[model samples]
Target: MAEASNGFFSAYVDSWDVLQIPRIGGFSGTVELPGSKSIANRALLLAALGTNPDRSCILKRLPDSDDVNVLRNILPALGVSVVAEEQGVRIQADHHRLSASSGEFYVENAGTAMRPLLAVLSALKGSYLIYGNEQMNRRPIGDLAKSLQSLGVEIEASEGGCPPVRVSSDGWKSQEATIQGRTSSQFVSAMLMAAPLSEKEFVLRLEDDPVSKPYIDLTITMMKDFGVQVLRKDYQEFIIPGNQRYLAPEQYEIEGDASAATYFLAAGALPGQGPVRVNGLGRSSIQGDQGFFRILESMGAMVKMGDKYLECSGGSELKALDLDMNAMPDAAMTLATLNLFADGKSSIRNVANLRVKESERIHGLKTELERTGASVEEGSDYLIIQPPSRMKSARFQTYLDHRMAMAFSLVSAGVSIEIEDPGCVRKTYPDYFLDFLKVAQK
Candidate 1:
């Protein structure tokens, strides 16, 4: 695998074979998921902002992915050094300058880079053109651009809020930014990460109810951990004073990704699979997506919860339960898989954010789930799924989103099926398919 600027395992899947795995054995074993790419990126930025002379913060469990590695490379560019600890990052990048060599900065297939860096470059004050890999560029940045513009930053888009985002410096010492609440929290995270560097102390507010409070909680936690003082009056209102210095201590650690844990939990729920116990993040953990386990209990999976371990086993005839995916939209696809096997019908609402960032998740999931014999319907903010009379053999499109590819792959555990872009799972969890295959015979 070729290394990306941030460094985890990153690969491009131009062509892949659609192969079938006959549903065979179930699994009961212990495995660990990679770090939350979201937290890694945020921590990298926070590490850069950390003021404590301590220099190192010990993180318990961290996942490795291309997005997080990009963050590692980023610190040194700004004169910070990131050393890899057993489970976290030790960071110290203090001197930052707008490198005048603004020709073309390329970040491949990284939404994390596209969002936060946009704010970083804007606050650093310079004329810069940010271009991404074809797929990354196609993802919408309009909501972010509009919000950035509202704060008096100049962000010119190619069209439809798609990227090749051109950001010019706003001379103000500091700026107050307002963003649409219904969109991805990445927009707000982007602005907050850069607020420490704004000439004046910054203030940020959301126009609507925030979509992902869990992610926002992560950002705030990382900010404070990295030695930056950030305040939120309510969930909607936040304040970060700029013109302060960014001090990086020697070390920090990233946590395991809870989103990735859903698949393993689901596999454990399969009848006669033994038991699946995944290590890393658990109760009292900072991640909100951890709540997916609760959603599973709602759908019939037996969950054994502990202070630091979540053990699940699949045995009951899954029931249909309506869900609100507004909190954790990234896992909506995983929820769709549970719905596919339900005895009745399940519906998901408040997930319109999928349309803007993912090319065609709703369509991709619906087509593939239906192709596998599940009755499903798609809409702007809702998805309806009716259990299939029988599972069938079908090849599904992944559209480069790892979740899409991995979520649908679950069908293979009980049927003969092929996935068009199985390799796409590497986008987040590089060893997802390979590791999953070891646990489930199907």
Candidate 2:
């Protein structure tokens, strides 16, 4: 397939089997990032839940991606009105309109959609068979299902706790439940979003610390924006009073994706004429991945934080450091690849959850990094990488993960590389390579 050009850089089209990313001298440009996938989906669900005949929620800057589209497309089946506008999407829903409906929903590898939809559907009068693509079925949802089962919702998953979850319930029959947080914070967030639908106060306890606690925090923050309050005790327990419903804001604007900004930030931190600026995310951002710029600063990158933007420039020399990345598992992949430009070996710990993401990320990262002549030590939950004396040009397999396709693009800073399945980025940022080409200089 020929690259698409519109007066600027060429972009890899979906029909292309492989994308050749040439060596770039440096990065220098501003990228206006798309709406965050986490916030977009959460806000979409909340908007739909809060929707009424009189009040239709207008969400601004909602990302147009496969993940967000999954929820957008499925909301109408529950009798919710979702209209796509030039600016964003408008959701109109009434709980009274929701009836006892039964159908199969294909979420297509979107965890944000599958996990939350499971809880929300169970809260409504419905028999839902929520399944996803092959990879999504391989991912676990049993922990979330078990928690809902505790609330008197009949829920079941495939053997080994995978997806294709079947949920049948009239509504919440119990008020108290406990969820194991070790696997995913989405389970807790899902429960919290549905708790307000209960007749009595809902109390939820955590069995363990969640892998991505910031995501839960983001969920609560967005929930509050929708006029729901959740009381929590040090992230261990949560209390959401019943007899409340989300009040859709007249207009809610979603911030840019911080996770996607990691790529540009890492590129700016490379040795080049950099100083790349990513607009729409800044110090006041709610996303945990916004902290990724600080990781670059720790690696000797000059960083500037504004109220609504983050800027980065390469420092004197990049330094390696060991850190626990449980909070920012998504950005850890960029950090792992960034090691190629660092001065020493680096260790990323406490991100075992990567094993169950869109792909087996931990093992996949180890494989691809080693293919590029880097020495990688793979553990059950950690990866230690020693940068090679010299980087090599190699073809990187994306494993059908969006992050994999984007994170490995950093290799273009040092060597010409080929990325397989560049189309995988459609899961989140479809125009990733187009934006990447903006900052890259030959």
Candidate 3:
């Protein structure tokens, strides 16, 4: 079957490098994670659409990861000038909109980029068509489409509720738009970031319980940092007064990803004499995913978290427990890795919300890990993990999911594995291969 399109863009990608991961001691060095993919992509859209009285908008702590880098590289082609520096990225959009005619641009699997960018481009009142690869097409954006429909934006879909979604912007006439927050926080975030430009304020109510409330909260916090005032959170109800234009901040820095820290943290606890230390992250901040460290403790991992650093060192046999991952689904992948070393069965529940994301995380992770000699059981909203009597080496299929590739890399502790599409790690961690090597051999 032909790869799915977002309705317009297309690309042929294959034959990435062959990759290998080895069992290493726990990590002990301070690892600097790339900027938050979540925040970096969101900030980029705001900056691209933002107007400044004097100069272009400057965004900081921009990660050198592939996803952000791709967006930066394609911005100029799409008619926005992006200035790249070690310190940050700057853009001078000058209010020129994202039109459909902008040369062909492929967003890869950066769902954070695809969803919000679609909404922002839709509000620009111009014809702009966005397309991506197989994985990007697989990620569901139908909820986002419905909300855009309510705002008078036009979307054309390909299949599987997939993209090739040709979106055209119309001057937004915001009315009360309710979102189902139980699925993915990105939908809520898309509306929150784009609502500021609409003619009428938006009254967004969460149709059911909000699963990833922290991420939606982070979106608002970042929006405010970039000069958009989103009203306080009232249960599931959120009010954003539209026409509140965004001003590019003199400098905005994206924090290192707390979700990325989970792997190293898990390695520290998984029966290794080596030490693992995560660096360049605030010990405390608004990111709710940071709370995953608490979950690690509950799983019997030895952890020491500080103001700006966290260290995990393996001390005893690890046992798993039922974990609620709704607020931090990104960390769920790491939890899957740690579960393999567990002495007893463990389950991570409430992550049914992850099915329609950049990948079907639960099934993909479970299916792939099973190839590495693990007894895996999948439930609608949870995973029951039973470790194999002994670990064995096997090929690990990454399915183009960066987290899937990284999380499964830990299998090297028990097996010598080959990972296909290992290059996918570039999505968020461009130097992941190098970093994994340094930490493993050290």
- Top-TM-score candidate index: 2
Clashing pairs in 2: none
Q: Which rank order by TM-score, best down to worst?
A: 2, 3, 1
**Candidate 3, 1-442: lDDT as tens digits:** 1222322111224546446544543455557776777778877877776644355777877888878876777666656778876666778763444433434557887778777777777666667677888878877778778877876777776776678788665566667777776777888888888777675677877777877888888888888877778886664888887677777776777777777777777777676534677776667656787787777666666777777777777766776788878888888888887788888888888999778766788898888878867888898988888888888787777767888878887777676667777767778986665566555642
Local distance difference test, each candidate: 0.71, 0.89, 0.73
TM-score for each model: 0.89, 0.97, 0.89
TM-score of structure candidate 2 = 0.97
lDDT of 1 by residue, 1-442 (tens): 3332322223335556453455545677766767778877776666565533345444444456666665566556555566666655566544444334243456677788778888777776568888777888788788888877776778798877888989887543436777876767888878777777764678898888878878878887777766567788777889887556555444555566888888888777765564788777678678888898888777777888776678888765776788888888888888888676777888988888877554667777787788878878888888898878887777777776778877876776667666666666666788786667556642
Clashes of each: 26, 0, 18
- The top-ranked prediction according to lDDT is 2
lDDT (Cα, tens digit) per residue for candidate 2, span 1-442:
4555533233456634888777887799999999999999999888887878888889999998999999899888877888878767788885644543798899999999999889988987778898899999999988888889887889889989888888889888888999998888888999998888775789999988888889999999999999999998999999998777788898899999999999999999986548999999988899999988988998889999999999999988889999899999999999999998889999999999999999999999999999889999999999999999999998999989999999999988888888988999999999898899889877
Candidate 1 displacement at residue 435 in angstroms = 1.8
Q: Is candidate 1 or candidate 2 better by TM-score?
A: 2
Model 2 steric clash total: 0
